[model samples]
Target: MSDATQNDERSQGVSRRGFVAGTGAVLGAAAIGGLGLPAQASAAEAATAASIDNGARVPVLIIGTGYGGSVTALRLAQAGVDVHMVEMGMAWDTPGSDGKIFAHTTKPDGRSFWLRTKTKQPLSNFLGFPIDQDIPKYTGILDAEEFSGITVYQGRGVGGGSLVNGGMAVTPKRENFSSVLPSVDVDEMYNTYYPRANAGLGVTNVDQRWWESANCYQYARVGRKHAERSGFPFVFVPNVYDWEYMKAEEAGTVPKSAVAGEILYGNNYGKKSLQKTYIAQAKATGKVTISTLHKVTSVSPAASGGGYTVAIDQINTSGDTVATKTVTADRVFFAAGSVGTTKLLVRLKATGALPNLSSEVGKGWGENGNVMCGRANHMWDATGKVQSSIPTAGIDNWAAGGAFAEVAPLPTGIETYASFYLSITKNPHRAEFTYNAATGKVDLNWQTAWKQDSINMAKSIFDKINKKEGTIYRTDLFGTYKIWGDHLTYHPLGGVVLNKATDNYGRLNGYQGLYVMDGSLIPGNATVNPFVTITALAERNIDKIITADLGR
Candidate 1:
């Protein structure tokens, strides 16, 4: 066998078929205390739900149980208004028959994707060998939704993107913040809402001494070493993971998760997703209820009424509609992430449900300039055998070239001298979503070549580091080993943009009491992990909404 092939065998501990066959447990690894565990909460158990098809009228109806929806639910419930939440995906609290709460990133099954027979993994290959396998179609955690030229990976569950992210609670720099959301009050966000949101989410930092010696973060240390060698400022990025728990994990006193290279799917331990944060508080209010497996198919003006009417489909495990329900609400909030919210609004407006919708309804959409690239490191710059899935640092080159590249974790357990990064650059290309009644779908007019701008911006840092270290880019990651995977985005933002599409406080223009409280409101991008900004913006908007608009 070739040296590379031998290395693959040694690193993976099995061949492709062998790894595929051994799936009795989570990721083929024996339960090491805390890996692929901490069952996700079922929607039914997470919050109370009113029976569908019963014609219940709510004061406020929030669609999707994500950051925006959950935050709205909490704030509105705090204001003593009864709220009803609709989520198209399943609740993530329960574990499967395998006695595990989630599937491992390496060994994905029915729990990997949203309605697909084969898994569409972000990390599709290892050592030039394709690692993706067939999975029984089920509503999985990660939804790698594809368009013509790009694949957007979004989470499908109660907590939304928070369920399937790296738990990086990042806020954009103040200098770049105005461009992210110019209409909003900057002082209110940074001084008030950002702090409130971060505190609510339990955002924390890693211990520096522990970070330097922790086995899980050795890959990061190697990255720091190189970034310092190249004279670029390397900085630590805060996370939502519990650092104390991570320390306990490494000490072997607690179950190993981030240390066991568990991320990208979900971390059953040490990581605090929205379920354990906002949604938990929202549930505590007891005024908010969530209905899972219920997809909002149609929304329109109430027949001879003053409120909005919504048509919801209650689907079974097979995605077949078992029942249809209708809800009438005085106010409606769209918290269905960027794609979900935009698709619904675009379809509704185009189909005459809300004809007076602004021309900006489906405009100003972007992928946040996301690009993934890896470099082959020399033996002296070994990235480490054990890599933490949660990245805590990045190459700070945004000042020089408007790119903030996170030194991401490979998390494959067995490392092969490689350094990877997922860069968020300021690529100023925005697309518009057009509704095609023929296909009954929303189409975004974005070209794959649009990513080249981001790639060039990201290369500003990598090219410098490469020249400094005399290394090269990896060829196996995005199709052809050396070529960057420049066509996919984990962060999808904007469609029903803020200020233009909605009033200053997220009230849909020309349609009062119709609000949008999600990442869809951002003009195009957040220039960071969109969740924190999405959360903060939701706070900023809802606080004003509750004070200025509601309780009137």
Candidate 2:
């Protein structure tokens, strides 16, 4: 099959059955997530065969299918707008030879890292030995994008970061909301958008009673014990994982996902990713279409037309560009997460494609004050061998220590006597993405030394815990004798910040129909897991944009 046809099929095939079963002719929201095979597969295929033909114009074009993109597409499609979303990754709908769509965390293959020859596991070492191994370069799920100083780990697929994240859907505390997005109306978000985003994303808390005794959560319990002993609050954070399904997995009544250590790359089941929530609903609207493996390379104003001309490159599994296509859109939404959107916008401004874009486009980028470390739990406090990858609780030291650390799992399939944590601190350093004209690429000026602030902030929490527990830090997780994992960030925020690079409602300052509706809008930190904020802010921005801009 032609690449365009394959891209179109992968984009719509998984949800086609659900769509057909709901509305007969088009997809419907209630049935698109996991409906069985379409009653009329051939007809559904024919109906969705309208691939990205060159020169075709769409009502709206969205770049990326992450949380922001998914939310924007769903809402716009509901408002009778035809949206074409272009994603730079695979559909991830087809199972591999192992009869699984996603590879397990411990046994990663070509299905793990995006276009890389070697696996870049966040935990680079184990038991004083390097764990990364060579693999065939493929368009995999996780993209450990390297810059000057940091490796930003982002998810690449039709569902975007939702495919690989731990599903820790945390809304910032009401009082801290002002610092997260100062320009936004506090009451509107707290009372309306946050709840809408949480409900739409299927966020729920784990049964605390069950968590107290679950074997898989022994790691979290150890973490809680240490935090409580250190006088820090141990809080249960809500996640997008289906708690009941996880209970069934523990009971051996269903196929295991979280309990089987199915995170990092992707979760095969139970986790409510965008594909199972927003993207599914968008496809069900019958007004939204997608093209996978099609990366947007340029977005310039059309010489003759009123909308923007988007140039896309269709790539293969080996990351080779086979075809380039150009299409026009009446409006465009930059929902490519923080790193992707920032890089694109920065490059566009420098290369003269969108020269009118303000300098603020590339400023105010941050790593969300992310730092990771592991604790050496005493032999008496053994974290279980069979651990759940879906994290459910965290240590809240944000008030005193400037850190909120999630009790992450070390699912090495063995009792490692380790308590892992990913801490989001209150580091105030902001970086910038600059265009490297010499290299014809974008570079982030985020120095490795800048992470010292984050390390110091994180130390405020772990130091007290280690002292209270009379334990030392684990040195084998990140590297040999390395105490802090400060070289990477899973949460990349800002660049095209709200009310800075764009108007109050995400409309680009100089471009009328161009907008940013992603993590790029948040100025650096969300004080918790950023996806819930990304989804909620997108919900708020798109609602205002549609009402004022779209002639609905």
Number of the predicted model whose TM-score against the real structure is largest: 1
| Every candidate's lDDT | 0.81, 0.86
lDDT digits (tens) for residues 420-512 of candidate 2 = 999999989999999999999999999999899889988999889877776677776677789899999999999999999998889998989
TM-score per candidate, in order? 0.92, 0.91
Model 1: per-residue Cα lDDT over 4-87, one tens digit each = 444533433332222234333333442232233223333433432444545877778899988899889888888888898888
lDDT: which candidate is best? 2
* Pairs in clash, predicted candidate 2: 19-27
RMSD to native, candidate 2: 12.5
Superposition TM-score, candidate 2 onto the true structure: 0.91
